[model samples]
Target: MLIGDVARRSGVSARMLRHYESLGLVRPTGRSEAGYREYSSEDIRRIFHIESLRSLGLSLREVGLALDDPGFTPSGLVDDLIRQTRERIAAETELLTRLRRIDAAEPAGWEDVLRTVALLQALGSESAGKRQRAALSSAEEGPVPVEALAEAALSETDPNVAGALRWALARSGDTGLPLLAEGLGSPVAEVRRRAVQSIAEIPGGAATALLRQALTNSDVVVRRSAALALGTRGVANAVPTLIDMIVEGANDVDAADALSALASDPASTDQIATGLVGRLARGDVEASARRRLTQALADIPGTTTSRALADLSNDDDRAVALTATYLLTLRGAQ
Candidate 1:
């Protein structure tokens, strides 16, 4: 068949077919008398194999090497792909676990999250040598029993379950936000806080709005959680509300947390730097708030904070002097 016919059949473009040929990944069996490339049924089969391998996250180079292997088996390739997918899923779950811990305030809950994280680390270490043994053992046993193991794993009340759920929601933020947003209005403060925390980890406009709405929760903890979540999104629109909460709010810890979140976001770092510098110049802000705000600004990268810190170097206030020194340390300027 012609290149166009192969493209139509395989859903791959002719340009990609030529590129694959140039890479030695595919070749035409022969050329017609008219000088057009001719493909065989075997060629189409190889193309489909390449596409499937690519979908499994294998690089073209790796796929080519695997295809060239005399001992390569279909089952072996499927097992490898499944293993790779599981590893990626595990890594994402671990990251989400850490994020949830950071967002959690209660010592007991945070410790539980930490323990799960440690277990995941240990599992990775222990599994490295066992995977090949397990694969070999599975071949002798006739089937891997993956479905049974997955069912058993899912039925357990593991602390890592929350991490896995949070990870899934983060990856599927578009689909998860509605459920999370609804949870924010739940009667339980803990549920509302978790919802806020999960939404904060997801970056999107709807998540931002959900967090903003959460700021109105009657419970102080819920309100603080929402403020922290909004800070993660770092939209300019949330700045005024966060600043108001910090400036007038009685909860010093929550205010400081919100400021830290705002400062960590690169988008809000410049504004945070300017606000902190203005407060320092006026000498009206509380000492603790000023200290936290200055440190937060210095922690974020960019030229804006550097220049702002340079201007503060001459300030007589002890907190300003300390923050300036910290900023200078970041620049390796002593």
Candidate 2:
């Protein structure tokens, strides 16, 4: 077969075949009577082989080494090719993500598109200041796409930057909740915590519902954050986790305050007080936890809290008894 037939049969362009010949990767065995290049079967096979190696992302020189070097080992070169291919794929994927995010922003013009792209690049910047600025400017830069904010929030290590991203997501309303909720399911504990924290800041019944659902998350941090947010929102469902926080001494002061806030509802006051008292009554309750629980009771009013406080006043632990006594005296004066 001549170059034309080879090009037709093997799909390697004639010009590329000549380039391959020029590179010494392939050569025809003989010339036609007209002095045109003619390829024998072996040369045709060699041409196919060159195409095969080229398909593996081999540079022309590497392909030459692969085909000509008697001592060349495939394992190392193949591994290198695999790594390069993976890198290329990752680059393409990142570019696709940027394009999709820009499309989602629905830029009004080229300037809007550029601003969104710049903000996205800044959001991923190594400088925490840039990341924070990008996050703060996202809303002003034409809705910088919630996915970008959620992704940054999930991975952000800088506290100030993370706060700005959370604030941006909150300003986005509930649009980012689904992504943040997905973040909650991430195996990374920090991501899950950030997810719940961001979700908690969003102002909507939807966020409140997600926080309530997150109360059962397997991650203790997620459960705690969700519980605290729900407590502030007056969701009675957080009562159990809030009470547990008080007992475990994990952010117990905030937990106690949340419980106190929930206690203002006449209907939930007794329920909240009872949950606190039950933890206090547990035989396994530690001295410190019992004291914290007793202190928490100071904010809950009504006969249930007053009675629990009276019972706790005589407890064996002197500190617990003192705290309960102090609370009861105040209760009586009211």
Candidate 3:
């Protein structure tokens, strides 16, 4: 068949057929008297094979080697491709596992995920070439197996084990919610606190409800966790709850953190400042609590919080006065 006939049959153009010939990818069996190249059945087969391999992402050079080597085994190439694909899947599985673990009520099993990441890093260090590194990087960026890790975490009763899982899940964000929710009801206050803290990192409507429930929990630690969770979520919906805690709850780091969360937003600052001032006026909260709330309010900029801080700056409590002074300095109101 002529070059045009070969091109038509192979779906390649006549010009490409000549170029393939020049690259020794295909050769004509003979030439017509008119000087046109004539392809044989064998040349046509090679062209088809080249096209198939190219479609599979093989380069021309690799395709040429495969075609030239009579002993070339497609099975070997297929196995390598499968192995690479599996590695990519495994990497993705590992990432998702970490995410699920973070959201799990029980802790996630992050040892395997960490190990896999370490292995990838090591492979990168020992990579034979840039291509291997690129492949490894691509695999690393794939989805993780968070569900599996969450399941593994649920099987363990150890706090350390659970903490590790929580750490891994926290890195991935809200995927660990279901599992974390389970921990919220744990018998142990510490476990509940950890779970609440993990959920707080992931602010959502669902998480907000969970934290709200925790605020009314029997354990102070649990309640504290709820407050901190609300703070981390930074949702204005938590403002009323946090204010209530500040007015009625004992002076503690968690309460301080909750106040900070409330005042973190410019919009919430006024309400929080007003609440703090009210608490001070009523003498319902301790002097220490008042100081913490004053500082938290001062952390917020603008006129409302600033005026609130100025009132507290002359309070009988030295700490409250100092904190208010510090806030005034921060706001350039000194």
True-structure RMSD, every candidate = 22.8, 1.5, 17.8
TM-score of decoy 2: 0.95
List the global CA lDDT of all models.
0.62, 0.89, 0.66
The TM-score obtained by model 3 is: 0.46
Residues 125-144, candidate 2: write the lDDT tens digits: 99999999999888886747
Q: With candidate 2 superimposed using the best TM-score fit, by how many Å does residue 160's alpha carbon deviate from the native?
A: 0.9
The reply for model 2, stretches above 4 Å from the true place, is none
Query: Highest TM-score: which candidate?
Result: 2
Please provide, for model 3 over 269-310, each residue's C-alpha lDDT reduced to its tens digit, 9 standing for 90 to 100: 777666666766775677666665675564555677777777
* Clashes found in each candidate (C-alpha, N, C closer than 3 A): 0, 0, 19
Error of model 3, residue 6, in angstroms: 84
Error of 2 at 51 (Å): 1.0
Query: Using TM-score as the measure, what is the rank order of every candidate, best first?
Result: 2, 3, 1
TM-scores, all candidates, are 0.40, 0.95, 0.46
- Candidate 1 lDDT over residue span 1-334, tens digit each: 9999999999999999999999999998978899999999999999999998898888898788777778766676678778989999999986775555334312246554454344333333334333323322322332222222222122223335434435444554355576566667778766666666667767777777877777777766666666666665555445554555555544545555566676667767777666655655555777665665565555545677787777666656687777787777867753
